[model samples]
Target: MTDPNKSLWTATARPAESDETSHETLHGTHRTDVVIIGAGFTGLTAALKLAEGGAKAIVLDSVEPGFGASGRNGGQVIPGLKYDPDQVDQMFGEASTDFIGRAADTVFELIDKYRIDCSPVRQGWIQPTIKQAHLPTLKRRLLQWQNRGCNAEWLDADRMQKLTGSPCFVGGWIDYRAGSLHPLNFVQGLARAATDAGVTISSQSEATSLQRNGDNWIVKTAAGAEIIASQAVIATNGYSGSLLPKLRATIVPANSFQIASEPLSESQLNEILPTRAVVSDTRRLANYFRISPDNRLMLGGRGTFSEPASLKDYGKMMADRRMLFPQFPDLKVDYAWSGRIAMNREHLPHIHQPMPGLTMALGFNGRGVAMGCSIGGAIGEHLLDSRVRLPLPFSEMKPLPLHAWHPFYATLAIWYYRLRDQLEN
Candidate 1:
């Protein structure tokens, strides 16, 4: 497997190497108001909120915090869900559109409150379309969001070409609520903030088992440590495994691969993505790309189901970048990495309560960064007060049929989508 630490973000982000020592392994029995498994964005954000509310919370991760998708994402903090505003209204009610539209606000708010230095750039996110047939959908999407008071703007072919410095897109839209950041730094900052607020986070401490004991839940760690708490949260998104077989069966972990080009020259940068806006496109398996703080062209898209083995695994991504910006100077691949995305059939973030005093949320599709923090904070609030409404509705867990053969099914699906995308062009 490719070392995740080899990624460009990890090499440049904050939370110095010495800071890893702060997350000690859990070795003793402890008591807290709540115990959370998987110290990624969701777990850390929830713990931070609970601690701020004067509740004792303990977070345990098999590896260190930010070792999962939280630190490995493309860092484009786009707001809203997979559906557009009108679809959100028809499916989840009108109120949901407003909340979902501003989901990125939570990310920026948290960054500002904690003073996280994650190279935040609110230049906006562009969704350009290479397929002309998709223009009507983009039009409706823009109109609906604008009607809801969102800062969404339409981009004609000329405007799109001017902004992206590419003539491939016929048209697109830009959502000003979106932005990019150093993902590793943002998650590490969350850890620091959560610890400052009195949340106990343990690294290399896996929750081996959980059993109900009277009114509390007893969680045993791999290192023979124990934690008894009144509430428990399963915040392990794409990394959730055999520890909870049923939960793992509810979603497919799709791998996303990314490659970073060598830092671009000032002239090259000006000729490509001159506005520095993060971009994605209108395709079944969309390609997302951004300009890194160090000026590297970071492009990403879906990958094989398994962990990547070498740079060749990202060959398609590198080719895509070159095709998008052929005017660039010599482009060299400096980094290649992959992260799993939790995808469910519904294509929405799902919250579930399978048992008493236990809450679980996962399946953010490709929008985990903003949704994870927003939904996590809401989960924390709901746990503190039942009357507090959640941004998403809780549904019963329905494990996908033939879950074990998901790899085969996902591969076939990817092939179909790839063919469809090609045919559309």
Candidate 2:
């Protein structure tokens, strides 16, 4: 049986050399060209890019790098935003959508360019339709990507079954450019690259407050250390805390839980997900899954609105996994864990400048793995040259209504979605 408490990635992943680096807690004043709060993919990528451009960067995180959603994610490198192309264009206009759409491809490019050893398998991503009613949206989604010159294709029920080795899906679509990777390894690799590129990373250095000093910002840490920088990037995402109350209020942090089964026998593996492509379903409370590099089946989905008190609390998720992959009827789960996803009302990643000399990017919905890195790169470019326009349209930060009741409402919303999915299917 899997350890109910440990994250599969943390328990099984080969430790990166970056993890061995001794990141002392911030204890004194420090200065850098840019201060990045949160050492997740976004901050690490931004640090790497800024260092490459000869800019000095100091990264501070409450915990170690990749300790948040960046490491705990399902590891699916899905391209594009949570919204469909038409919705994106409708919300942000054609020019911004086109620009952001192209930037979504940067994740794999970065992996290839940096030679990051994240065990990336670029076989594409499949979104299967769990209900006949889902076929129209799948077809429309395929057309949207096809119109953008993406190598996207729609698949009939037989093709979906053949590709996924399951009959649970009626039909689906595949995005040829999408793929999967060991997300923890990917983020750790970025940290190593950032360190090698001369960026200073300090862990266990939580930013407790932020204050402006003329053209610069002074970020105070819990350990009495402060980072003075002309520019700052708040990349905390779902972990955003009191350092910026308004920013935290802008996102509803929803918990996502995942479980991994013991490595399957070669015969069983071959009979399941033979294409080795990452897969997710069309339900609002969808399930995403894939075979890990070591042949373990990793299944994940929306869990409780708040963090579950224990792995036993993931009973629903575990049950859902078994239902989705009945071929593994005797599967032995090896790990279970959960993390928060920053959900925006618009169902899209948000880039905002709440104040001058400060930039904030969060709310990727559930598509953070690839989009976070892409947006981080854009932030780096913007920091280097204010004239550089980011693909994501910048907007003023607007806190959601009834932000204080987010946990209650988020739980209620999940229940509603689950009911809708059940009825639709």
Candidate 3:
């Protein structure tokens, strides 16, 4: 049985040699130019940008930095949204495509500019077609990105086998612009950068209530501390709570579980993903995997709609992993953990200002690692200068109808998808 408390990333990630930021707790009343709630990638990235631009930003989180999805994701720096390029163009129109395209590239630029030591590999990411039926969709996705001037390449079975060192994939496409990294370390690097730039990060400071006071917004913490700011950002993506009841109702938080095996032998590594690129299969309930810098095989997939009580409950995932890579059928999983993913009905991120002085960016679906980081900068720019245009259109918060029944709906959807995936296979 895997340990549910410890994730493979947390267990194996290199500790920061030196942390320049002070782990101060929030106390008393404080005032800042901008107050960001949540210390994940989005909040930290926004705080870093705002601080760099000479804004006094204060970031508050209920737990330590990178304690959420920011640190607990697959770490695939995949460029683009959950939607295909053509779908985005069709949904939001052609005029929005350029901004969306540029937004995807900003994630890599941020990592480079900050010199984040997250074991990032720019080898690229592969979305392989697991079945012949998936080939058309893969081709359409490739053409959509190519139409948007993206440097993507289609890979035949031979090329896929050469790169992945596996014959499971029939065909695939490689996005050179996409890559992978140690997600936790990357978020920690962002925290360091944000603090170095003079952004105040208060850990263990949960914002309980938000109220408007004249021209300013007052955020009250559970410990009775308060932050009064001219502008505020609700950057809490999946773990968003009742702090903003309306905002919480706008999206559903689905759980994604991941498992990692003990370090593989050099020979074992050579026979699987020798090029060390991130690979994800084309399935409704897809599976993604890559080799860690230390040679551990990290695998992730959509788990139960509800959170599991223990890592031992993920037998299905373990079986799935073994089936996918029969070459390592005896792989023993050392760590298992799960995190919530904020999903919207549209499967795209939602950027909105539900009220004056309050801006929110959430519902990245499962693409929050790159999209969250990029959108953070956009949030910083937007907060700094309202006139600045955003990559995603700002729309009013549209609460999902019958939001209370989301859990029921989520369970039904998961079952439907799982059944469909089985039927297709």
Per-residue lDDT of candidate 2, residues 249-344 (tens digit): 999988888988888898878777888899988789989989988888888899877566766787887788778777667687788888988998
Question: Which of the predicted structures, 1 or 3, would earn the higher TM-score when compared with the native?
Answer: 1
lDDT of each: 0.90, 0.86, 0.85
Q: Which pairs clash (backbone N, Cα, C closer than 3 Å) in model 1?
A: none
TM-score, per-candidate, Cα-based: 0.97, 0.96, 0.96
Alpha carbon lDDT at 38, candidate 2:
94
In candidate 2, how many Å is residue 145 off?
A: 1.3
Worst 10 residues of 1 by lDDT: 13-22
Q: Roughly what TM-score does model 2 have, to 2 decimal places?
A: 0.96
What is the Cα-based lDDT of residue 166 in candidate 3?
71
The digit string of per-residue lDDT tens for model 3 on 65-141 reads 89889989998888877677877778887756666666546777777888888888877889997788989888998
Q: Give candidate 2's root-mean-square deviation (CA, Å).
A: 1.7
lDDT of 1 at 317: 88
Write model 1 residue lDDT over 71-137, tens digit each, in one string: 9999999998879888888887887777788788889999999999899999899999999999999
Best by TM-score: 1
